[model samples]
Target: MQLPVETTDSINKISELRNTNLQNILKKEIDKNALWKGLVAKNLMAIGIVDLTDMSNIKYAGINDNLMMYAASLPKIAVLLASMDAIENGELEDTKEIRKDMRLMISKSNNAATTRMIDRVGYEKIEAVLRAPKHKLYDEETGGGLWVGKRYGGGGDTNREPLKNLSHAATTMQVCSFYYQLVMGNLISDERSKEMLEIMKDPALHHKFVNTLDKIAPRAKIYRKSGSWRNYHSDSALVWGPNRRYIIVALIDNDFGEKIIRDLVVPLERVMKKARNLEKETKI
Candidate 1:
């Protein structure tokens, strides 16, 4: 249970330029929207967004990011990363069957496929990938993000996540960090991270965030994972926009969770475009 001597230094040590600017802009946008305000009044929602186009001028923010919520199928992103890690460590084989299963698990959100992978790679290894010092997508300080406590199927307890004890738990900040690491080629290794991100690219499931984002930005490439179970609907993605690149994650626990995710896309895209325009103006 001990981390490396310095493991807890800080999980998101990429760039620490305070979230004030991003928060202010996002708050203004969210507050001005009537539907968004009504949705916020009803249920739990967590959001994390960052503009990756300019890492040097990294702008990022989150709302209720620390409240760990059931991430549904989203934590499968952890499984994808763990599979790559195991292959690199020789703990798990990189066979066609394994790769296919991973693809199904991710792209299709196939629970059976996910269980096969969870059994093969072992949940411990997946969590290891999250808690790894180099990655630490889920760590003690962050209250343990991206967790899979029980089997996806053939389940019994189906209880909750480990560190925080919420079934299939995730934090928006952690999910975004995972994507950030993948984009920056820091999840495992540059080569392995790219391979994993490629798997996440062009997700097969087409609802919620995918549906909304695709409608708004037809040309953009989205590497995403989403989960909709009862009242929990979650979506997170690394969006390669035509003129901007950023990461956005939403975890909503509400009756309107799906619609809420759908409604937020264009607005977030506009924020990215605005940031880009300002960047261009400064250059000019």
Candidate 2:
């Protein structure tokens, strides 16, 4: 899907600050580690990274733009935005129940809770919200996997396409761009953005990524979400620093456990910290 005109403009503005150093940084990372070999050994498909701090500086380490993988729980971020939009427009109230379910959907990756929240906001509303001024959603429609309704424990086939097929997935690039808009308060109200960040702060729900991050950079505040399927695994995070924010996305469709974590997570954290420090020093 084409990015909206306003979004294009914003992207152009951010792209002007493209950090060329990040390219060499990531290239050296991939070359230095044998984890890419392990990822291939496990039949991994594709991995893509986007630097949200500077949209124009995006780095794709694996396959090119054609690579598409199942979004899994990453789409929940879009759902969360839609729900918040509804609440802000007075179409839906931010009741205790709504807040509770939103928290569950985001923090816990609770499919049932997500479906319930989607039901409240309605699918059409979600679609419309994404097509709004500065947000966009791009993907294909395909068959066979976990239907949203059934996957969420609801009792209907809904005749909808299954959520799995690689053909019906999104690029890591698009997902990261969508998230950047949300983080910068361009997709929703500031109040809503703050609310969403608070939900992301829930350590219990974000344990998978946060736990690893805590070990390496305990003092850093990182907000992340992960998705997994039979052979695919992905994690996207916004690392908050004293002077800058960094976006890190790691995707592996392999079973190389410790290797994926060490090569991707550990080194990515180091890169992010170095980027953060450099930005602070340069006052960018």
Candidate 3:
């Protein structure tokens, strides 16, 4: 599937703004403390930062464009958009069943619920929606030659190659781009975007990401979604502050600690808080 292409003008502008500030932030971190080392030991990872106030202002640090890791639940944002688009188009009824599973798939990250939602939304429709202009959903399997096997009764593993799995895998850059597109009202209507944001606001589903942030910046309101598979884990979300909103996505593919919330999650959350504070002080 041909995913949506970002606008050249927007891309150029965002690239310039992000690149200009990215180095400064990195330098400050290196001078103050060596936080990057902790991130480095956790296998390969990527971080994409965007100013939610203005999509054109964006920054990417650490393997920004590299298609290195699996998307895992990160793609759920696309599924969420597809569901909202279906509802808006009157193609799928927002019946009780649809509503229930939509909540489960997105809010709770329920694998079975997500699978059923995928069946209802139809793979083709989801593809088309993502392939639209300025969208960011890409066909990972075709590019990497990876095969993702179906989940066995929700938890069992299937004999499959990591690259082919469509159920849960995506590049870090692609995932961040998707959120950017949504915030810009490029992929779906504004009303639909707001609806999706509401679903993301559910605290129950944001445990992994929120738990981390709560410890550091408890006052911030976070709308986020996270996914994990074996050694791979990802968290993507929009962080809201009194005067700013930022989009943060972090992916780690290594055995760090017992729980993702403790090891990778808290660290990422602290980094985000640090970034947010820097942005505020610098007024970038």
Candidate 4:
């Protein structure tokens, strides 16, 4: 099934959806979970969730959503966006090799493919695009959002974001904004968003969020990107379901970050489900 088409007001209304009800619901869930609550207290874990079941009245909430952290390969997504921007602007050639590498880079999280794309686009291009007025994806004022300072493969360092100075860094809210914009067809353009979504569909690696999602919602269409490096683990997904739709993004720094990410799926889903139910009751 295809994603919902963008409406005339999507771009304007797509800013951040901060609803009090949803905020309380999400915060309560996290507080009840011992592991999540503790990590959140230490500012080691950040989660951003958006309930898209009612696009007209979208709801969003997060805990430590603006806390930037080392996100490993998750920020390859910034490279993907920059590539699309370059392609659309005619700054980069649209060749078969580029297309193939884009797919491998995102789907498989292949370091070699990612580094090649980064080389082609360059850190300057990525930085400009991220800080562009329309996107503000890596705004320093907002705690520095999605940023790709270093290449995926072994490299010295390109341009680490000024705020956190992490090579590959992301804040939950910023990553969430990326997915939200993509789904809204505001990333570059509608057609470009579709192309990027195609590349992200059916992630190659099946750990973290995808690991548990594979079993629980087998039929749902999931477009996701995830990463893991030593103690840092991160995952983000745009889950499109028959009855439920939402975006979930997370960044973690801990020895058990992998398990923390995997375990996050259920509670996060519950938050979405509970929010949906509450929305129904209000309507009734």
Give lDDT per model, in order.
Answer: 0.76, 0.56, 0.58, 0.87
Question: What TM-score against the true fold does each predicted structure earn?
Answer: 0.88, 0.73, 0.72, 0.96
In model 4, the runs with Cα more than 4 Å from the true position are 4-10, 13-15
Instruction: Estimate, for each residue in 115-220, the C-alpha lDDT of model 1 and write its tens digit.
Output: 8888887766776677777876777676667887667887554535566676578888888878877766677777787788778888988888889877777787
Q: Which digits, one per residue and each the tens of the lDDT, describe model 3 over residues 86-168? A: 98999889888888787777778877887777667766676677655555355443232111234413554333324444455
List, in order, the clash count of every candidate structure. 2, 0, 10, 0
Tens digit of per-residue lDDT, candidate 4, span 128-162:
99888777788877898888888776755578889
Using alpha carbons, what is the TM-score of model 3? 0.72
Q: Highest lDDT: which candidate?
A: 4
lDDT of 1: 0.76
RMSD of each: 5.7, 6.4, 6.4, 1.5
Segments of candidate 1 deviating more than 4 angstroms: 1-18, 38-43, 156-160, 275-284
Q: What is the model-wide C-alpha lDDT for candidate 4?
A: 0.87
Better of 1 and 3 by lDDT: 1
**Pairs that clash in candidate 4:** none
Which candidate tops TM-score?
Answer: 4
